[model samples]
Structure formats: structure tokens, C-alpha cells
Target: MATSTPEELPSSAMTDEDYGAYRASAALWAGTSVLITDQQGKVLVQSVDYRDTRLLPGGAIDKGESPAHGAARELLEELGVHTVVDRGLAVDWVSADSSGAPAAMRFPGELIHVFDGGTWNDEQIAAIRLPESEITAVDFVAPARLPDLLSPADARRALAALRARINAAGTVLLENGHPIAPTSLDRAGILRTPRARHHFTFHTAPVPDTLALRQSWGWVFAPDGRILLLLEPDTGAPCLPGGTPEPHDHGDATTTLHREAIEEAAARIARTTYIGYLSDPAASCARARYAAVLTAVGAAPVDAATGRTYIRVLATPEQALQQFDWGPAAADQLAAVHQARHRLGIPRAAQQPVTELASPITW
Candidate 1:
């Protein structure tokens, strides 16, 4: 065929409508969300002038930008935040039909990528500069109150991201903002303690929703990278250093754990992380679990309250799992924490050689 000049090409083939039709896809919207947390684990959400409900600090991903980079860029543009996005928390695929009745006219579907903005101190939060034109106000909201402030879909997405952050388990995948079946947390059994007919039955916490139990326990770690395990003299059953809350156990679960550490292990904790909860429905009781770092204080060989000589062993997570039998419940707790630390990139301290643990306990 003879070559046609640019101007001689068919008029129907060169229209903008044809170009647009060729680029059409199943999805119409692509966005990013940043889940920013404070040192205390409170998520930072903003009230936008465009919407009554609060949202995470993020917006639509621009052309040629990665979802993570887009999230960080949106934070800087909207709130003047300079923090780096650490890891992906979640990715949600939402159908347009599920959004509302008039949705199909607007777009096909939506994809949202959520990233962890890491933790900031009070000073860093105070330093944030919000653009009044877009963001009306910025506040750090507790995870429990998120559902009340955000839409159901947004709330579920945020909560899933929060769970991923708290557990240090990898990213969560969602459809319509709800988890997509057995999540990493579910697969790892991080919060699902074994259930037995008469002994224990694990259940999720409903009210308050933060913990499974009022009573708490701690896997307090010594400076030498060993966890403190208390031994039962007669039965030799190993347990974390904690007990039921007392009248004076005030503040939060960490406060209760701190007191328990002092009473049970004779050690003071510098900091504590809320790992998760374990419920025993058969006994009508539940317990919050924590991983704590010991302060300068050391444990006493004997408990003053019982006047009994205690055999406390500081063992590596592997050794603790093997040597001392923590029963099914306690074993699950330690295993969950071990998995969390490994996932979160928390480094273990220098371990003592196996030969060094051969000596018998004295004093």
C-alpha cells in the first residue's frame, strides 16, 4: 500500500476518544494511606476539610510514583511530616459497587496501599505543620476509638494495619477493607492460644477490644539476651513473671506487668510492649501478654512474700522452649513473641555458650 501522510490518516483513528478507550482498565482509582504511630502506639489520623470523617495522612498516587513514595509525599504535602515509610502494612482492593449505589458511574474499582510511617515522639508530633486548606486538624487517636471516628471500611483497614504494626508480622491483605481470610497473624497463631475443653478456650476480646484479659504477664528479658522464666519448685512448670492484678495495679496492662515483675521476679522493667492476649473461656479468665526489657534492677534468689527459694533461669527463647515446659498456654505466648521479634527485626543480645549453662545454681 502507498504510504499516507500524517494529515491523510483516517479521521476516526486519530480521535482522543479512541486513545482514552484503549487506556481504560478495570480500576478507576489508586490511592495510598500512611499509618503513622506515636511512641505509645496511638495512630495519627487527620480531619480533612473535604470530609467530616478523619483519614490517614495520604492521597492518590500520582503518575510514575510508587505507592510507598506517594504515601510519604502526601504526608509531606498535607502535614509537613518528614518521616520515612518503614514497611507496607496493608493493601485493599475495593469494588465500586460495594461503595454506594451510584458508584459505577464514577469509576470501576479502587486500590489502596497502606504503609507504616514508623513511631514519633511527642515533640515530633508537635512539630507537624498542617495545611489548613486541606487538613483541618491532626491528632493522634487510640486504636480503640478509630472505629467511632472513621467509616466502617476505613476503620477496618486501619485496625488491620494497627494489628500488623503491633505484632510486627508482615503486611495484611484486604478486600473491601476486611482481611482476606487467614491472615499472617491467623496463620502464625500469634494471638490464638490453644484451646482445650476443660483447661482453656481462646476467644477474642470484645469490650474495650485492646486486650483479652485484665490480668497480664511479661516475658522480661535480661541484658544477656535471655528471658526470665520462673520455676515452680514442686511441679517444675515454667511461667512468665506475672500474676493477677492487685488493687494497686493501676494505669494500663504494662503498669500491672511492672508491678508483677517487681513482686514475682524482683526486677524492674525499663520498657514494655503489648504483644497480645490469651483468653481461657473455660475458667472465665483472660491474660494480657507483654514483652519487656529489664531495667538496672536484678532479681532476688528468693521471694520475700513466700520465703521460698526460687529457681529462676535466664534462657534463650529456643532453650526456654526446649528446657522448661511452659505448658501449652505459656508456651504459645513465648512462641508468639519469638515470632514477632524475628519478624520485626529486633536483634537478640549476645548469647552465652551452651557450655557456660552447665553450672548449678547457688545462693
Candidate 2:
């Protein structure tokens, strides 16, 4: 007996394909422009109310506009600046949002085309003519300080671009007729910088094992210059009133540090200054290694329970170091803290530690 073969489905019977086509038609397109310039080898930035910090000036590329043409037009409109495009700097695919979500909305992907524009002085800058509704302020900013002035991620990307330009130039001419080469600046893009990283890993080993440990520590300062030190209930060693970040800690490193300070010391920190990182000399089993610094913005309570006493006393750096025993990582941690403080121009207080007195705080 001959068996009949199964009949094939007709293309007209496919309903799923039609639905997929409909979804593709509903997708939207969006784009943004980022303008960069180097002044004396520093990056120039502008401020926008939409973001908490400053950013490069650029906006959406209108229909029928190439990214290069859009960048030149946007810069002129936003900052009244004009320049000759040197070359394409970079092209990045970024995701952004079109909904203007209360938080940043994500776009499916953005084609960011970066171009090189030779430096322009203030006199050479064209007249800026942006609508007040779109722009607020414009200014020049240093490249090394970009990390602090801009959001960390933006800073990192901008730094990469800025460094690329610096490398291409090979040497920067100072106003004093001095030609400074890239070698003058460290590979990390800092000049006249202290031996920060070396002091941590080589001199003071902050981590015992390499398991990526990030702890939050805050130094509370009074107007009189006295820093608040917490005597651990278990160790009696003098140290800053801060603790390890909790699993639920939300927000960035600074936010986590502030939250930790409030929880451990019962004091709220108002202001902060980023110090830098410290690590172990040898590779540790830990995965994370970073450090930061913060100066107290306002007065902290002497006793969280009573909420009554507030005293302002200053401690010298030496005194503060001597009085506090930082536990296992004390030496490395304190060194990082002091280094940050000095960089920020905070004067160390003068106080003597009585080595005979012993006490420790329990974690």
C-alpha cells in the first residue's frame, strides 16, 4: 500500500511573522552629539540642568544631518564655538531612552561619532546663541579633574578620548614656551601627583587576602578642626566612625559611604572629597579593592543617645594616627585617609596618644 506524504503549510497561514513585522515598525530612532576640545591639554565642558554635573556640549542630530555636520552645528548653536574637523575620534554605540523617563530612558542604541577639532582660545570662541530653555552654562575644565567633575562613567569615557588626543599630539606647549611631553604626565593622566598607589600596595598592605573587600570609612570634622573618632567597644583603638557596606546599600560609593557613616556612628555626613584607592602589595584572594575620603559637612553629635553635647576639638594628623589603632588594615587605611586629607588641604590636628591605654571596638 502507498502512504500519502504530509501536506506542507502555505506561507499565507503564518500569523507570527506578521506580528513580528508590526513590532519592528513600532521601534523609534534617537541620537545625541558630544563636542570635545582641549585647552592647554585639558578638556572643556559645559553644565546642563538635566544632569547633576557638567558635560560636553552636543545635541540631537536633526533629520538629514550627518553626525560630523551635526557636531559642528550643535557646538556653534550651544556654545557659539566653531572649528575645523581634524578627523574622526571615535564611534560608540550607546543605548539611550526617548521617553524622557523620570530616570534616564534607554535608547535601543546610539551611534556616537566623535571627531577631532583643534583647540580654540576664549577670544577665538564664537558667540554662543542657545535658547535659554536648552542650555545654562559653559566653561573650560581640566582633563585630570574630569573624573571628579563629571559622573564616573562619563568621566572614564571622556578621559579615554582626551588621552587619545594627547597621545596624538605627542607633546603639549605650555603658555611659557615650554614643550612638555606625555612622559611628563603619568600614564594615568596626572601631573605633580604623589606616589599614591605605591604608598598603599608597597608600603601599607590594606588587604590581607585578595577577596575584593570595599569598606566605608568617614572622618567627621568640626569647625574647630577636631575629627570625630570612634573607640571600638572591643578594640579601644581610636578610628573613624564608619563601617563595612551592607548588602542592601543602595547608590554609588559616596552614597554607600554616607549611609554607612549614619548607621555606624549615628552621624550624618554633609560633604565629601574623593581620595583614591589602596591595595595589597601582593595579589590577594579578594576581588575588589578601592578607597575614598570624605570631610564632615556639618556638626556631628557627641552622643547619639542624648543628642545634646557637641564639642569642637582639633587633632593633628600625627595625633589622630597615634590615638587610633585601625585593626588589621589600620596602617594602609589610615595612610590613604591622610593622603586624601592632605590633598584636600585639611590641616592635621595636634594630639598625643597614650600608648599605655588599650581598648578595642568590636566589628
Candidate 3:
């Protein structure tokens, strides 16, 4: 057998122009079916053989077929999972190429239509026959853990959307049909309202002070895409490094967050990019919350108050979720942290599993 030298190889091997042109002529489309259980909120996923990566049950949409129809068909054919097609979840245009850029010789783009479908129980799911050529295994995954099972980008986008739905579903009513405002709640039947003619008279009397409550403040951020949380010494659960804002504090929430970072974690934050807020108003307290991206510049302090020496490093979101010690926050707090990270443009691969903070009664 004769081995060809680099210089002796045919020039045809050096160029992909022909292949590129052929790809350009092909019209490409894709679809993904998201099987969700109303009872458990778990999605059915399949593990692909190539990378042992998990993916939603789906495949390329055939010619002359709608994406939704394609998704339904693919689910039944690939996994033998029958579902009632409800509506489209997300319609994203992605590249068929790994670079996620437009193909040089193929169609301008590939459309990924995600359709939401009703879910199945463990027994029901166990009965399905998955296409062995593409799917290696199938399992039901909680919405919160979906990020760990799928590609970073796909997981982040999906999780963000799932959370938005959950938050919307958790809306509460206060009086008649009106929703309760974060800072105020009605005290008609449950608690008595205070009444006094003069301010001095009110001060003089031993008036019931059941209405007053303190608010919690904090800045939530993703450090280099990973969540930077502190283990509260008291609760031993993970929490964003923040505290109640003082009366004299200046600037916006971002500034307060910077101060909190220094105080709680002994880390210096160079800048903060705002994401959104969560309302935590209840019998115990009321808070106007804020979240952001916390960028670090240099060394971290050993101690916040003492200003002792400390080691500083950057970690991906996954690392933070696995390593950080959590404290008293609800299990849903982890999901909240992840939602904030998704909004900050952190890729899914960098995100860590947050301990989910429990939903408070106040909403």
C-alpha cells in the first residue's frame, strides 16, 4: 500500500466548495416535542448516543410539513409516546452548523419549533418504545434539573420559559379580585386597623403595632456566569450576599449590591447589570428585590468586617451549584438564581443548580 504525501494529495481534498454548494441546495427544518406532566411538571427526555447528551423527543421536520405536526409525528414515531398537541412553546432559528452561523452552501437557516404536549406517568412512559438508532435511553426530568441534562443553551432558554410560566401560575388574589401589591396588604378581617385623631395622641397611647414590618434587601448576580452565593451562618442555606438597605445609603440598588458583595463575600464587584426583581411580601416582611451580573476584578477579601486576606477565583454556574453550601432559603431559591443567570446572558453550561426557594404565602 502506498501512502500519499501532503503535497501529492489531490486539490479536490483541500476544498469543500462542492459540499457547501450541495448543502445550500437542501432546505432544512427541525422540531422538538416537549412532553410535560401537569401532575408532576416533569418533562420526558431522551439521551443521544453521540455525547450521551439528553434531548427532547424530536427530529428534523420533513418537507411540506408544519413544525407542530412534525413534532407530534416525531414524538410518536421516535418514542411511541402519544400526546395531545397544545401549542408552540418557542420558535428559534438556529444554524445547522456547529458554529451556529448561517451555512455557506445550505439554506440561510434551520427553524427549531418547540411544541408543548401533555405528559405521561412513569408507568405510561415505561411502556413506550424509543427509536434505538437515535435515542439511547429515555427518562423523566424535573423542570429545574433540565438544565443539567440538555445542552447549555437549550436548557437555559427552556428553564427561563418554564419559570416564567410557574411564576405566572403562582399569582395570588387579596381582595375581591384585586392582586395584592408587594408593599401593602389588607388588614380588614385578620388584623385591626389603627385609628387616632392626632399624631401626638397616637404616640401617647399604647397603640397596637401589628402592621409594621421590616423589608429585606439584596443584590443577586452571576459571577463569571456562575452564581456567587453565601452560606448564611445561621441558616446554613445559600443566599445572595445582601442585607437591609440603610436609610443613609446612596445610589441605586446596584450600588447597594456592590456594598453587600464587599461585606458578605469580601469580593469586589466592578460593575452590575440589572436583570429583574422578585416580590417577597408577607406577614414577616416586604421587599423590593433586584438581580444583576456581578463582575469581579481582583483579589477577594478574607473577611468583610476584619478585611483579612482571602482567595479569589472565577467559577462556572455548574461549579457554584455543586460546591456552594446552601443555608435557610427555600428550595425554589436555586431556581430563582438560575432564572437571574439566564436573563444575564450566561450560557447554560455555566449555570449551577440552585436550591429551590419555597414559595411564600404572600406571593
Candidate lDDT (C-alpha), each: 0.64, 0.47, 0.46
Candidates 1 and 3 compared: the better one by lDDT is 1
Candidate 3's TM-score: 0.38
Q: What TM-scores do the predictions have?
A: 0.51, 0.38, 0.38
240-345 per-residue lDDT for model 2 (tens digits): 5455555676525556667655554545555575543445336442212223233332434344433433222234444444332223354555666566556556
Q: Between prediction 1 and prediction 3, which has the larger TM-score?
A: 1
Cα distance off (Å), candidate 3, residue 32: 2.9
Best by TM-score: 1
- Could you tell me which 10 consecutive residues in candidate 3 have the lowest summed lDDT? 183-192
Q: Write the per-residue lDDT of candidate 3 for residues 55-143, one digit (tens) a residue.
A: 77777777788777788788788778666665654555555553244456554445565555654656776778977587778776655
The digit string of per-residue lDDT tens for model 1 on 50-111 reads: 77789988889999888878988998999897767758988899888776636446857789
Residue 239 CA error for candidate 2 (Å)? 36
> Which of 2 and 3 is the better model by lDDT?
2
